[model samples]
Target: MINQDHFSRLNQYRSMWVLVFFDLPTETRKDRKAAILFRKNLLDDGFSMFQFSIYLRFCASRENAAVHIKRTKSRLPKQGKVCIMQITDKQFGMIELFHGQKETVPETPSQQLELF
Candidate 1:
């Protein structure tokens, strides 16, 4: 018989990856400060810099992802384009990355344990 623990382990496919991409106007001093502050907020929320304007965080489930997305929206800068996307862990694992002409694998974050 499949146990609850085993069933729980099989649900990893439902895990989520939240990605934020932004292009903020940094020409003016105020614009620059806002951009910096936006980035800081993402970091404070446990997101890691995936690139200059890309940040990502892993969430255990869709509900958890929604919480982070809402937090991100509340802190958005006023004068730039920002996009937030969520994908399942299975989809995220299939992404291919490149550095210049060399292909690279994305760094997989350590699995986070969820405690009820």
Candidate 2:
């Protein structure tokens, strides 16, 4: 059993995640440039690319996740589709992945850089 304070503190660490899945057109030169710029923006904003068109980041709370989602929306290109989802860490952990015909290792979310 856990005490009230300990339990409350544990609950403070909400396991929320923000995932950005995008499908942008790259057929034309302008479309390709838009896609590349979108990708770079995500990286610059501390999101780690999970796959070719998927990215994920962990957040301390739902509000923090919302801020990222809003930012993503503001930067979306007018030519493609972008979706954002917030899921619990447990749900994320349940995802199964395979590379080609072999199973692949799970990805650990990237940590933020710290200044000394």
Best-fitting candidate, scored by TM-score: 1
TM-score of 2: 0.80
lDDT tens digits, residues 1-116, model 2? 77998765554456678999999999999999999999999988778888999998887667777888899889999898999999876676677889998888787876765332
What tens digits encode model 1's per-residue C-alpha lDDT throughout 24-104?
999999999999999999998889999999999999889999999999999989999999999988888889899999999
lDDT for every model? 0.91, 0.83
**In candidate 1, residue 3 scores what lDDT?**
98
**TM-scores of the models, in the given order?**
0.87, 0.80
Worst 10 residues of 2 by lDDT: 7-16
Residue-level lDDT for 47 in candidate 1: 93
